[model samples]
Target: MDMATTTSTATHTSLASVTLEVADPEAARRFYGAFGVDTYIRLRASETHSTGFRGFTLALTVSGPATVDGFVAAAVDAGAAVLKPATKSLWGYGGVVQAPDGTIWKIATSAKKDTGPATREIDEVVLLLGVEDVKATKQFYVSRGLSVAKSFGGKYAEFTPGQSSPVKLALYKRHALAKDLGVPADGTGSHRIALGSTAGSFTDPDGFTWEAAAPPAPTPS
Candidate 1:
């Protein structure tokens, strides 16, 4: 079955924010503030206050020095494990943190004015598929009217359909990909990723899954 057809049934929402675990909330806050996110919320648990904020929210995060310490403290107290302690990255005003769930969070202090190169807004979503045989998988996609955009070290390849908005359908070897993601190689089926305009999924050789989907059509303004 062509699983890509099912993406239309999925919800279409713009990515708002993501919350992660922090070892030292205060440190995380400081680090993230320096990176560019502004923290507008903080909660604490104490003897007098057995109850605290019910859920996490980053809607008001911004960048600044004044709120950094508090933000980091709050994050740690809420159960985040620090991955990379706050430090400058080579690319820009940002720091990397691995949350308790193994999600990597990149906190930035300032937007890089000199990104060095101008690129188009992603017209296509890239699906990182895990496969057993790269050549066979490429043939499947090619038969479906997709063409290769590029190949990464001969192991990973990206394919794009001619009629679509230049979105990519990519394939990678399962075991190798799992190692790259630091995840155990036991999972099967596909994981879904959404973009602004289209959606699709790919199943690779070892039964690893990947998806790239575009959002639903927009409503009239």
Candidate 2:
């Protein structure tokens, strides 16, 4: 099969939005939107649907140790399942939380390995793609015009987004991600999220869906 490309393909530098089809959009909105001004929760595509890992994760990168701790604490307090408690790693200090929406969040701080007092701001946010075949998925994105910032032994990879790139993207082995989340590696059924890009509508090698962002409908006078 041919690689799918969008009609109005988003540039490598645009922010991509994740569209989740939830049983209760209102509940999703209340929970997700509270995290930040940018995070959004909208309507579902269908009344009947399924939900799971969805092959992606929401990463909140912070510069302060307090910020990471605060974020982690807040996530847990807000009904998130703690996947990994706050700790230090090669990349820096960080932890993982599975939000109520089934979106896994990695709260991290590369600036300091030590914990500190609470801070309110975030350094950056990234959308991480978890796939069964890390190497092949990395190749697919590379072929699609994205450049890599760093890479590891066919297990982890990071891509540098153009200045205009909306959301920073990365790739990780699905099983490894499952291990991180403390869950079974096997995930199936519809991913239950839609991505709209100026780049256009296309399906990835892993079955994640993307479409062009539709303009707002005109209101009647």
Candidate with the greatest lDDT versus the true structure: 2
RMSD of each: 13.0, 6.1
- Residues 133-158, candidate 1: write the lDDT tens digits: 77677655554345566655447666
Q: Which stretches of candidate 2 lie over 4 Å from their true place?
A: 1-15, 37-52, 111-117, 162-165, 215-221
Clash totals for all models, in order?
28, 13
Error of 1 at 6 (Å): 29
Deviation in angstroms for 206 in model 2? 1.2
Per-residue lDDT of 140-197 in model 2, one digit per residue for the tens?
A: 7666655677677577777766463356777788777767766676666777777655
TM-score of each: 0.37, 0.76
Q: What residue runs in model 1 are displaced by over 4 Å at the alpha carbon?
A: 1-125, 152-154, 161-167, 189-215, 219-221
How far in Å is the alpha carbon of 44 misplaced in model 1? Answer: 34
For candidate 1, the TM-score is 0.37
- Each model's lDDT comes to 0.38, 0.67
The true-versus-predicted C-alpha distance at residue 92 of model 2, in Å, is 2.8
Judged by lDDT against the true structure, how good is candidate 2? 0.67
